[model samples]
Target: MFRALAVAFAVVLIAGATTFLALRPIEQVHSSTPVAAAPLRATTTRPTSPPTTTAPPTTRTTTTTTTTVTANPVSVVENFYAAINERDFATAWALGGRNLGRSYTEFVAGFDGTVRDDLTVTSVTGQTVYVSLIAWQTDGTPRYYSGWYTVSNGEIQHGKLSG
Candidate 1:
């Protein structure tokens, strides 16, 4: 009876120890704070040049005088009309800037059957020159017209026609 009771107590103690181990929470021996890893080194054999330094710019004061020479607006308009009256379309077109926005053929066609009879400069304001003119059509009918021409860089840039 004594040996049986001793064997039974030993079995109960072993079972109790196994149950406590299985239910207990596991613990770590190290700290929870993260450890910083060492920086990795690069292996390269490329040659590097030393940094360069530049001198500061010097400060100076100098006076500059500019001169501009422009052709007379009245003369430019007169020359352009003279070319048109002579049926010299190429010269007329050349006298105008790229802003004319018309082809040589179109320019000639627009002036077809038109002859400039007379012209007079009415006024000159800065780059704009105004002129009054009388023209004859193909049927010999007379037409009166007034125009304001804008000249720039020694070339006729644009024009507005009115009656």
Candidate 2:
């Protein structure tokens, strides 16, 4: 578990340092009605340590996380999903995974079967950015979801997303 965590952290660092990153599409929404993702629930909990559990044999297991932030508010949302894609909950939490509305452990557990997230910034209105996401499950099913994320500075403040 610890080795896996190390790999996840390294992935986040390499992704952050790598300059050949894909350019994410950006556009402004001109509609009178803004596309907003309703808050599933807003709870930001910062866990000092990764989650762990004990078994009947009195053995414990550990895990890992990863993240890096950019100044652009929209980029914050992008980074958040990036961490999720890498299965780096630690980095995801730092990148505003807290806004996903769950404790660190629960938040990590939430993406149990999620394989990857293909994200796009559909619109930007001040600190609010609308997003369209395709969450792929391990079974190879793609679920479409659209929502908005409210960012402050480089952290995701809160927002809502639903499929």
Candidate 3:
């Protein structure tokens, strides 16, 4: 790996080629052994050159995105009727039948003479869902209904559907 240093003053060339800024004078010691060493020099005056300048290091940034989706309120009304059409009473109850202002028995009794519920959603205004319903009877009579249902959190809070 490479190493770096930003020297601001005059650089001194010592024995080795490594770069360094000498803050004080350097002297060589006399020895009796025959060891080889480079000559030494000292400097007492401050450097007259201008200081060097460098730009700051660069940085990187990261970002992430997320998305959310919500179901349509009219679909809830469509599902509620779909459960009834499929004869799944418990599913119908949980979907919003319990909020239709009637007991579970009464809710089931309302469809005693009914054979099928062909549901058609006309329009949706905020939390209110309007629909056109054709409830086919066992006697082959098709009953027509048109009304709006109040829905909140995917559940029918109330309904005014009638023939």
Candidate 4:
């Protein structure tokens, strides 16, 4: 359990650093909206008089830019393990997506057993993730299971476990 927790923390640290480095440059931050160049002056012909100076046309420009912070998908998976290991059911349920929230609520509504386990995350690819865990049941039996968790919009959509 200690090892797993350490690894998880390291992964999160690395990911955070990577994101910071990737978004450090000003060009990268403002790449979405390019600045427009100043317009050229119109040429006029005045044979008898000196050239007339006119101030550039007053242009009012309004730009609307939307900024969205994409939630890290791996955090959800990590939170799931962390919350479950800590026996914080409400936190675990919130980590799940809408569907999982409903499903887990229905499944554990009348249950009273606690799950103490260590979770080993095998892989996380986009919205698909895998984890291997060892859980100790109240009856003193060791339960080993592997789970495949599907995530969408940064939340765990659903998860299936097999022993």
Compare the candidates by TM-score and give the number of the best one: 3
lDDT of 1 by residue, 103-131 (tens): 77777787877966577899999999998
TM-scores, all models, native as reference: 0.54, 0.55, 0.58, 0.51
Per-residue accuracy of model 2 over 125-156 as CA lDDT, tens digit each? 99899999998999999999999999886888
lDDT of each: 0.76, 0.79, 0.77, 0.68
lDDT of 3 by residue, 40-140 (tens): 55444433443455557889887887755445788888889889999998888987899989999999999999999998889989989999999999999
lDDT of 4 by residue, 71-133 (tens): 676777888778777777777777773455356666454234545777788998778888997
Candidate 4 regions exceeding 4 Å error are: 1-65, 101-106, 109-112
**Distance (Å) between predicted and true CA of 66, model 2?**
29
The superposed Cα distance between candidate 3 and the true structure at residue 126, in angstroms, equals 0.5
State candidate 3's TM-score. 0.58
Off by over 4 Å in 3: 1-70
lDDT of 3 at 162: 79
Q: In candidate 2, which residue ranges exceed 4 Å CA deviation?
A: 1-70
Worst 10-residue lDDT window, candidate 4: 42-51
**Leading candidate by lDDT:** 2
State in Å the error of residue 149, model 2: 0.5
